[model samples]
Target: MTTSSLLSGADGAVELRGPLASRLLEKSPAMKRLLVYLWEHRAEELNEYAIATEALDRRSDFDPRTDAAVRVQVARLRQKLKEFYDDEGTLDPWRLSIPLGSYQLQAEPVTKDGAPPDLAIQDNPPAAAAIPTIAPQPVVAKPPASRYLWFSAAGLAILAMGWLLGSRWERQVQMSTASSSAVVVSPFWANLLKGGRPTQIVFPNPVFFTWVDKNGDTLLVRDPAVNSYHDLERSPSLSGLEAQRGKPILAQDYTVASDTRAVFRLAQYLQPLGTKISPSSSTELSPESADSANLILLGTVGTLAPYQAYLDKLHFRIPEHKQYIEDATPSLKAPVHFETVRESPTRIVAPGIVALLPGHSSDSFVLVLAGYHTNALISYLTSVNGLADLQKARTSHGNPEFFDAVVLSEVNGTTPLRSWVAAFKPLAKETR
Candidate 1:
């Protein structure tokens, strides 16, 4: 007959405030308060103005007719409720919900297979369908009848609720669809792809051999050393060393083999983000170029110019760049050093650095993927199961935004071997 009678006899009104209410309160205090208030007065003629003032604690002059804040919050509350049921309360026998277009809280007893009871419009007439306007069954109010006031209030509230409920549902559906189609990436790649800037890949062309003046003989310097012979090709002091010493100038060309595999793999990995990596020559890319975009330094330290500058800034030292030597640590116990064993021609212990650092400029990130030599660097980026290994390393280090870790790449020149986290620096503070 009336709104009160309809609500009192409703099938699912009693258990509306039980388990679901408690969980809702835990996640969102505002939603909990709003849901409780609406449930308490579900039977009365509700107006948007009244709901804003009472449940939302807005100012007395707050215009629910114009301000859409209440509608927005209600939409969020519905989404939160959906998440709760989908996750935390998935198996619960009783499901609580606020029906579309109405604030009335309903508790429908789910069947053996989670089927909700049939809530046809006839059985639950109070919770109206999505509509522009709705006339809730009239209530016999105070005498000298405020008929216009009651009707207008009821109409305004129901219209606000009904139209917005349907619209919010659509928005939620769109959001879910968007998220499903969104980019998925490894955590380590996130910093490199930060701010959606163009990513630059610096392929390391290692200095295989260079012209050098050693004593009176100008020789081909294949060894990278601290007291290395002067690069006769580029050194001003050693400009005429080859001619003066009566020796042939060694070939100045030094380049590592192209890692076509890492390039393709990275492209596929970043395809979801709609990013394309630009092939930047190590010599072509200057400090200023590296500062403008997200940089992925490929291969060994040779590929990355000014990497020594970075090491200086971060207080790390790797002497004798040719072979893997013990790092000059800030402390002997510091978790930032390398142990090398020269087995034969190459260093037996090949350690690598997968360091993420802040970009030189805003919205920039510099990812350093380097090692003792070309082989080690290539292994880390491609053959070492890099993405998986690096992700696990990042996780082990508490997943900091900036990190530098020593990855011991146990590889015997392309033969499969294990990798380990030799050392970790979870919080590598950026020196800006």
Candidate 2:
């Protein structure tokens, strides 16, 4: 009955047939299947493509770049395992974990005291081979000197969650929790946070073209028109630079510092009201998750492309791959186009929009805070003056549950100095 024996087929099959696997099966049949698949194929190098097609039964054409289903499921499975061990499996002599940066299942022995034997923890597994990017054309072999870096959605999620758990924001959240009983929630947030649904705050991981420079340093270029792998392949600018830089690879690893801060600020305000808040990256957002929880999306036009269905319905929106707000309302009023401007070497002016709409599910809601400069958009949305302006505008409009408002922010570099509401319009509930 040694714990090491659990790694054997017979012992493993016994555990799988026991209550542990059954619990996972009860949680999600797909998760149980994934666990069994990993257990059976423990010796093989499990990549995203293989796991998707083989374990998860994804189509042969499944692309890991655009579709994060496999990664999401794996992450959920990992969480489920940790949950099992923390509770029901506390007395189990062995624990299974998927090593970070790899898809292999690992078994670590546990002591009688319910703790692992004293051993130096190993560093994260080495990075895997670059998963192929999604493009219209077939992937061609490239020189080893130049290669793409496919960012993992799970890794980015961990980074984002780590920030949320940082001491700075955690302290602020603690303070907010103390005074939460006396604070009154505003109508804007009240409408969204009603029904006690969990809130998922998604921050964008915008697309960037990365290539190694002549000096052996990696350089990142952001072209507004290119937001996806497909866009990177067809860009006219990339074609000219391909000779020297090879083909530029698309990655969504970088998050604007302002966006992360905004999420913290938002969580600090909402958590005090007994609302559960979760921080996630835009890449990690899925249709099912969006429908199940209240979502607060913060990002630029290119980063928010996945939500184009909702963005299209907004009367005030920055066009795809562009940095300006256009008024699409067809009325007697004049056309509205507010573009980003450079007032001086030290100052910048940008347009932002705050839109509230119904979610995919009837009970869920969506709050989109978008702009060319997210620093300004989020700053305005969370500010007292900015919220007062929004409240005043909504009050005049009879306080519709769904609405869109355009705001202008004066910024110095990445910091937003001040923002003002430019326009507001209430929409019917069925507008979605």
* Candidate closest to the true structure, highest TM-score: 2
Q: TM-score of the candidate numbered 1?
A: 0.45
Report the C-alpha lDDT of model 2 over 1-432, residue by residue, as the tens digit. Answer: 222233353335544443344364465666777777776654333456678998899999987656878768888878877778778787777677774444656455575666743221112212211222223111111112223322333323333333333324444455445434444456667766778888888877766666765664555444555567776656556555676678776656546545665666567556546778887877788646567788888777767777777788889877765567889984566448888787876567778888988877777888888875665676566556678988889888898878998888876545455677778888778965
lDDT by residue (tens digit), candidate 1, 16-93: 434334455465556666666655553232345566888888999986435877767777766676666677777766
Computed on alpha carbons, the lDDT of every model, listed in order, comes to 0.49, 0.64
- Runs in model 2 with CA error above 4 Å? 1-184, 213-216, 240-250
Model 1 lDDT, full chain set: 0.49
Residue-pair clashes per prediction, in order, are 0, 0
lDDT score, candidate 2: 0.64
Query: Highest lDDT among the candidates is held by which one?
Result: 2
